[model samples]
Target: MIVAGFACLGPLVILGEYSASMLTNQWPPTLPLAVLAVIQAALLTLLHRPLTAIMETRPAQAIVFFLGSRLMSVYLWHVPAIVLLTGVQLLWWPMPDPGTGAWWLSRPIFVVAVLLVVWAISTVTKRWESPQPILSPRWPSDAVTVIAVALFVFQSLAISSYGLDLPLAVLGLVCTAIAVVLTGGSSNVRAPDVPSSTAEAMPPSPR
Candidate 1:
C-alpha cells in the first residue's frame, strides 16, 4: 500500500518531467485508501486468534511504543537539538558543507541517527518493562547509551567526511561488539503471556 502510494507520486519526485504542483495532489485515491485502511484495521481488531496472538507479543508492543515515543520525542525537541548542535559544531569545528557531488553522505548519517534514536527508545522501553524490578530504576541501560553515543559520533563523522570515514565505520562495528558483550545476547523482549482462553481459540496445527 505504501509503495503504491509512493508510485502514484513517482512522477513528481522524478522531476523535470512534471510542472510544480501542490504536494496535496500526491495523495492519490486518498479517500479510498483511508477507508480501506480503517476497514482493515477494524476487521483485524474483530478477528479472534490473530488479534490475541498479536497482543501476546511483548516485542510488538515494545516496538509500537518505541516508535511512537521516539516520534513524539523528535516532535518535542528535534528543532532545539538541531539548532543547539549546529551552533556548537559551527563554533567549535567550523566544518564546510559537503558539496552536491558528495551529498550521498547526508543519507547514511540520517539513516544511522534515526536508527540509533529508535534503538535507544526501544532499549529504554524494554528496560522499563524488565521483569527484574530493581533494574527498572536504572532505565536506559549502559549498553543503550554506549551504542547510541557511538552511532551518533560515527554519523557525525560521516556527515563531516562525506562517506569516506573508515574510522567511523570501524567505530560502528566496535559498538556492535560492545552491544553483544553488554546484552550477553539479543534482548528477548516479549509481551506478557496471553490468557488461556485466547490460546484455545487459535487453530491447531495438523497432526
Candidate 2:
C-alpha cells in the first residue's frame, strides 16, 4: 500500500501542477482539482497503516509526544516567527532576489531560524496548550458548548475578515477567553484506558 501511495505521487504532482496552472490562468478546473484532492486523500489512506506502524516505535513515540504537546503553540506562532525573522533580516541585510541561487540556499537557514524562534515562543506559550485543571465542578451543557464554539468561530472570522489589528486582536482574545471559560469545569466522565503495549505510549493519531 505504501509503495502504491509512492507510485501515485508522480501522477498526483503532475495533475496538481496542471490544476494550479489552470487556476493561475483564471480558469477553475474544478473537476481536475476535485480529482486531485480525492487522489491525495486516497494516498494518505494507503500510507496510514505503514506510517502508524513506524510511529509506534519508542523513539518515534517520544518525538511525537514532545511535538504533539506543543502542537497548538507551534501552529499559532510559526507565521509570526517567520515575520519576525524576515523583519530582523531586513534590518540587518538586504534580502536575496526570489528564485536566485542565494535565495534557495538561504531557505534551510531561514527554516532553522523560524524553528528556533517557534521553540522559544512555545516554551512560554505551551502552558496554554497543555490541559489545565478544571476550576469548577459544573460541566457546561451541550447548548452552551455550541454557543461558545459559534462565538469563537464568529470572532475568528471577524479577525480574518478585518485583518489582525489591535482592536480585532483584543476582541479575538476576549472571545477566545469567553469560550474557554464557558467550556471550562470538571465532569464525572473519564477517558478510556489504553491497553498495555509498546504502541500504547504513542499519542493517538490526529485522524
Candidate 3:
C-alpha cells in the first residue's frame, strides 16, 4: 500500500502542478484538484500507519512537541514575518524583478529570515497557546460549547468575506474571547504520563 501510495502521489503531484499552471481567471481547476484531493486521502489512509510509527520515535516526538507547542503562534505570525522581511529588504536592498535570477536567488535568504523572525515571535507568543490549569468545578455545557463554536465560525467567515477592517476585527476578537471564556474551565484534565526512562531520554523544551 505504501509503495502504491508513493507511486500514485508522484504522478498526482505532477498533474497538480500542470493543472495549476493551466489556471486562468479560474482560481483553481476544481475537477482536477478534487480528484487530487481524493487520491491524497487514499494515500494518507495507506501511509498513516508507517507515518505514525516514524513519528513515534524519540527524535520525532521532540521535534513534534517543540513545533506543536508553538504551532498557533507560527501560523499567526508567519505571514506578518514575511511582510516585515519584505519591507526590510525593500528598504535596505535593491528590489529584484519578480521571476528574475536575482529574485530566485534571494528566495532562500528571504525564507530563512522569515523563519527566524517567526521563531523569535513564537517564543514570546507561545505562552498564549498554552492552556492554564482550570480550577472551576463546572465544565462548559454542550450548548455553551456549540454556541461558542458557532460564534467563532461565524466571525471567521465574516472576517474572511469582509476582510479585516476594525468592525470585523473587533467582532473576531469578541468571538475569540467569548469562546475562550466559555471553554476555559474544566477540572480533572491532566497531561498523559510518560515512563521515567522515556522522560529522562527526552530533551528539555526551550522557553
TM-score of each: 0.31, 0.62, 0.61
- Is 2 or 3 the stronger prediction by TM-score? 2
User: What tens digits encode model 2's per-residue C-alpha lDDT throughout 18-86?
Assistant: 533432322343444555566678778888999899998999999999999989999998988988999
lDDT string, candidate 3, 34-127, tens digits: 5556667878888899999999899999999999999999889997898788888889978899879999998998888889999999989999
**Ten-residue segment with the worst summed lDDT in candidate 1?**
16-25
List the candidate numbers ranked by lDDT, top first. Answer: 2, 3, 1
Worst 10 residues of 3 by lDDT: 19-28
Clashing residue pairs in candidate 2, if any?
A: none
- In order, candidate lDDTs are 0.54, 0.76, 0.76
The parts of candidate 2 lying over 4 Å away from their true place are 1-36, 141-143, 158-171, 185-207
lDDT accuracy of residue 112 in candidate 1? 59
Q: Listing every candidate in turn, what is its Cα RMSD in Å to the true structure after a full C-alpha superposition?
A: 18.1, 10.2, 10.2
Question: Distance (Å) between predicted and true CA of 197, model 1?
Answer: 37
